[model samples]
Target: EFYTQPVQSSVTQLGADIYTGDNCALNTGSGKREVVVPVKFQFEFATLPKVALNFDQIDCTDATNQTRIGVQPRNITTKGFDCVFYTWNENKVYSLRADYIPTAE
Candidate 1:
């Protein structure tokens, strides 16, 4: 069904919009109920810094589930880091990309 309302979705100023769901349509088959929509996000810390991260949210229809997907910095290492560390004078920082996946499970 076409949304009677314009679904409001936003990304971080630095986050990359990967794929917005062309998810469901008025012609959607009953078996084709769910599809995964993910936003790829990247953050570059010019100055090495620590952050607590959260992607945005999408409201759902009944009997649906959504989840955060892709590689989370917090998942790979003890500390979720964009990069290992920075050298004082190097001026090189960290860059990371993670996919936020929301799906119906």
Candidate 2:
């Protein structure tokens, strides 16, 4: 027996651009102890994507005496965004490894 039938289906594609290998230093000064790490995407996205970050490794100057560290994303765009690494007191961040992933829906 031979039969012909058309199958109806829909496919949705999701994309996520990942950018890593950001090993920078954060030398915080007085007043506000924070560092703005600007990130530029390799390729521009069609729409504004959600930026997600993960601080894999962080090395501070002081090991024992160090304040709480905080991070935030600002000025997000289709091209890039900035990751702000801050601390309460004057604790200089020697180096840090941050990985960013931008996803579009």
For each candidate, what is the lDDT?
Answer: 0.28, 0.62
Per-residue CA lDDT of model 1 for 1-105, tens digit only, reads 676976754322333332223332211233322223322234332332333334332322322332222223232222123311111221211222223322111
Per-model TM values vs. the true structure: 0.20, 0.62
Cα deviation at 36, candidate 1, in Å, is: 7.8
Writing each residue's lDDT as its tens digit, candidate 2 over 1-105 gives: 999898754322232322222433445463356667687777787778787676766766655585566666789887888877766555666665566677765
To one decimal, what is the Cα RMSD in angstroms of model 1 from the true structure? 21.1
Give the clashing residue pairs of candidate 2, or none: none
In angstroms, the error of model 1 at 57 is: 4.0
Name the regions of candidate 1 deviating beyond 4 angstroms. 1-13, 24-53, 64-105
* Residue 75 error, candidate 2, Å: 0.6
Model 2 has a clash total of 0
Model 1, poorest ten-residue lDDT window?
A: 83-92
